[model samples]
Target: MQTSDFLAELSQLTMGFTPVVDPIYGAEVYRFLDLSTSNTIIDSVDTSSAEAIAVYIDTYLSKTGGKVAYGGYLEKRSIYDRSLYFGTQEIQLKRNIHLGIDIWCPSGTAVLAPVKGRVHSFKDNKNHGDYGPCIVLEHTIKGDSFYTLYGHLSRASISELEIGQEFNAGETIAYLGEPEENGDYAPHLHFQIIKDLQQNEGDYPGVSSLGNLSFYKENCPDPDILLKIESKVKG
Candidate 1:
């Protein structure tokens, strides 16, 4: 199959990268949650508090029989209701489609950069159910420019970072933030591949409403294209 020049470059870039978590590339099983399905547990999730979110994820992990829960790219989630920041009041179409891949794991788990890149921006989006502490890295692979966004990260992740600091592949760029500091939700890293920043700084939309799904999906392709963990997902 023929691939685009951009994707071809991305493919080359990922060849030497490591798993975001050691377990995903090892013997441990990882569950893929299809939040887009009608029977998903997302309907029952109570986002009232940080502890509640932890319990919800724990129960899900147990049910799926995996230490790590992955999936969520382009998946519609009802849990976004917890935050009014998602969409404009007049839009009616709420932003529930997740634009990034989420890795649900215990707090303090290390997060690795999948490629060599320079930090473009970093900020603490301090809203309930927001990205909390986030970092966006800019990269140029074979002349094709792109960006990687690491959201819901520990405050310490960007505490010492500068705008243009560089990171090599497989380097521990950050740790999974605790719920208290990670948008008041379960500990997870929201990893996204963005084709453009649209002039946004320190943050980008990780979710889009139904009306905007096509546009967002195009700008942010499936992260698995770079993650390359399709077989690791539990059947």
Candidate 2:
């Protein structure tokens, strides 16, 4: 497939990778994790249970000696099978392809803004398998405007956020929510960059079906363009 102009834009948009999660786990202790269906290791995981998956992630992080385990852009995952919120059992229509990069760490970990931006919207999406409390920030750097989404956030993250609330680079905007409140999944940050939100507010499609992957792939380019997490090794 051809590359997206937006994808190219995202690649060359900034000078270097910026840390959205705590810089405490920045380049040094960051590790790339594979949660896709192709990774046989995940097959042994109990993806349906948030606690079970947490154990799996914790074990991986401990063994890898990494503070953060992050990946899953456009990854075809089987974890969504337990939730009807994604779709029925039909393979082609199932929204199992993750469209964002997830940063797994302990609950209450701080989520930061990689760049200056104002709040676009914030909401509590309380579905069985949803983003839970989420925030979308509108960013304008180098005269280019787009939005960055922070999902699976703590409830307090959105309790006082205004539509135009501002956040600077590295400012604490939210915290990772617990599984009880974060769509029943392990505490993690779902970060995505979007060129267009399609009129969405705080919530957006972080997963896509096989039939609609093309459109989502263009609209939601790999966040790795800004993160460069895959290129870094644990120090």
Candidate 3:
């Protein structure tokens, strides 16, 4: 399907806050975070250290009385500079544009599906700054087929899984992995919507360089359109 058509279909998936992570932290308390290089606060600490970034997020969450810190779709992040897996420091070639919505939470936290889907593939991408223990689910709704990727998952998340397993909306599909196991970048879930896998199995590019930004932005639309976690729930 065309990106426009798929995005249009996604727009009609649902409205209101759809929890993609554990609901223990109600939708109301979820905070949108800024991790891009422009965030001057990032310069205050070490971005290369997973513990440092985790602490930074923890502080932000505590200060805002938020349970979860989310956001990052199409966000240009400088943290990727810490690893060569992304590419050289060259601007045009560097894959610094993040294509997924990262949910900052404690490790081992339950990760849920915002929509019902079946397992497409799963793998443990062990690169230095890559998604570790990832799972991709193929979902078909309204005759439009797409995918949702859950990355940075615990090993157990994919250890006993079958290729064609099915999961329902809001079902616990995986658990967050620790920094050591999750490409050493703090504990969080990298959730993305993929229109086309291009034969990719468990792994997909979560970041993109400026030169290829346009194409990736289309292939990977804003996940918030489906989750709607950015909006506050009305009391």
Flag regions of model 1 displaced more than 4 Å.
1-3, 22-27, 88-92
Best by TM-score: 3
Tens digits of per-residue lDDT for model 2 on 108-156? 9999987778999989999998999999999764576788999999998
Worst 10 residues of 3 by lDDT: 226-235
* Model 2 alpha-carbon drift over 4 Å, by segment: 1-5, 141-144
Clash count, candidate 3: 0
Poorest lDDT segment (10 consecutive residues) of candidate 1: 16-25
**Pairs that collide, model 1:** none
> How far is each candidate from the true structure, as Cα RMSD in Å?
2.8, 2.4, 1.4
Best by lDDT: 3
Question: For candidate 2, what is the lDDT?
Answer: 0.87
Give candidate 2's error at residue 139 in angstroms: 1.5
TM-score of each: 0.89, 0.93, 0.96
Query: lDDT for every model?
Result: 0.79, 0.87, 0.90
For candidate 3, lDDT tens digit of each residue in 68-124?
A: 889899888889989989987788988999999999999999999888899999999
Question: For candidate 1, lDDT tens digit of each residue in 169-190?
Answer: 8888888898889888888889
